[model samples]
Target: MFEWMAWTTPVVVFFTCIVLMLIAMTVWEIRSPTVMRKGLLPIATTRGDRLFIGLLTAAYINLLFVALGEKMMAWFGLEQEPSVWISFALSMLLLSIIMKKG
Candidate 1:
């Protein structure tokens, strides 16, 4: 059914996962309310707030790695494909830290 859409499989999966996470969070909040807490981010945040910040951070991290990684790779004559994996790893680490500490 998604074949006609212009989005790649990864894009579709990413968005689908986001939608599912939002739904899950909504249900979780309905069941048990979240309390605001201060974290390393310097601002008090609830679950949703942290999630929003984490997603935005992950997107920016990926963009930066892709944009700068290409230039750096070209400068050093290195392969470009590994940058994606590196960015993904870094983003995942950041996301986990945010979820745990933020």
Candidate 2:
């Protein structure tokens, strides 16, 4: 099962972080309802909406990074593809920004 995936440590950690975020968000929503409001995002959105958007953004970021990893390594004359952790950190940072201001 799941053999098609490499199931790397970074991949596991990234998914674990997402799961934890969803749980935390669910609890936060129950504790305090959110109101639709405008932020850095063009449209007014609730916390849940922002989370969804953030999740999508993070996925795209990770995919893009992975797709370009080899090219990036070649461009930089590296011995191997860039670390997946770079994508994870970038995705998490963007997710935090989206959560706070999107």
Candidate 3:
């Protein structure tokens, strides 16, 4: 069904994961509803709100890494490109903290 878009494997997998997460969230909500809560962020947020914030935060983190990775590598005298795993890990950590506290 996704063939027409001609997306690469990673792109396809990323979107598939996102779709699956949304489905899972929907099911969980139907089973047990979530309440809005205020966290480090200024406003109250629900599970869906937290998910959106996490995704946006992850995207920005990845973009910032991509934009500055080269400069950072050069400054540190690194020979290879920076690994994206760092950004992924940081994103997950931020998501966890937000979900737990916010």
Candidate 4:
């Protein structure tokens, strides 16, 4: 409905921007990378580096939500349920594990 969309427009725009920026960063990394030298070896040319970048991006997003989450929920007329908090916490833990592996 028009009314529904009118309210969701801003949220959609914000998310879309975030997605686009992430895609751009990823493409840039793939195209060009800055190298770091350690001792007598170069250690920046690794797939793990890309994985780490993605994980860091994901963590930044999650932290952004967790930091301003309460306000966003209230703005959207969403209730702060305990189960939701628990799920968010679990998700963060899972993300941490993925980062650790990376």
Q: Model 3 over residues 1-102: C-alpha lDDT tens digits?
A: 967888898987998999999999999999999998888889999999988888898889888988899998999898987899988898888888877776
Please give the ranking of all candidate structures by TM-score, highest first, separated by commas: 3, 1, 2, 4
| Alpha-carbon lDDT of model 2 | 0.91
Candidate 2 Cα misplacement greater than 4 A, ranges = 1-20
TM-score of 4: 0.35
Model 1, backbone clash pairs (residues 3+ apart or across chains), number: 0
The top-ranked prediction according to TM-score is 3
- The local lDDT score (0 to 100) that residue 89 gets in candidate 2 is 92
Task: For candidate 4, give the lDDT of residue 29.
Answer: 67
> What does candidate 1 score on TM?
0.80
Each prediction's whole-model lDDT (CA): 0.87, 0.91, 0.88, 0.57
Tell how far residue 101 is off in model 1, in angstroms.
0.6
Worst 10 residues of 4 by lDDT: 37-46
Please estimate how well model 1 matches the true structure, expressed as its whole-model Cα lDDT.
0.87
Ranking by lDDT: 2, 3, 1, 4
Candidate that would win on lDDT:
2
C-alpha root-mean-square deviation, candidate 4: 10.6
Per-residue alpha-carbon lDDT of candidate 4 for residues 1-102, written as tens digits (9 for 90 to 100): 567556576688867977886687578668985444232113433434544554566667666667776787778777772334554566557545543443
User: What's the lDDT for candidate 3?
Assistant: 0.88
Select the stronger candidate by TM-score from 1 and 2: 1
Candidate 3 regions with alpha-carbon error over 4 angstroms = 1-3
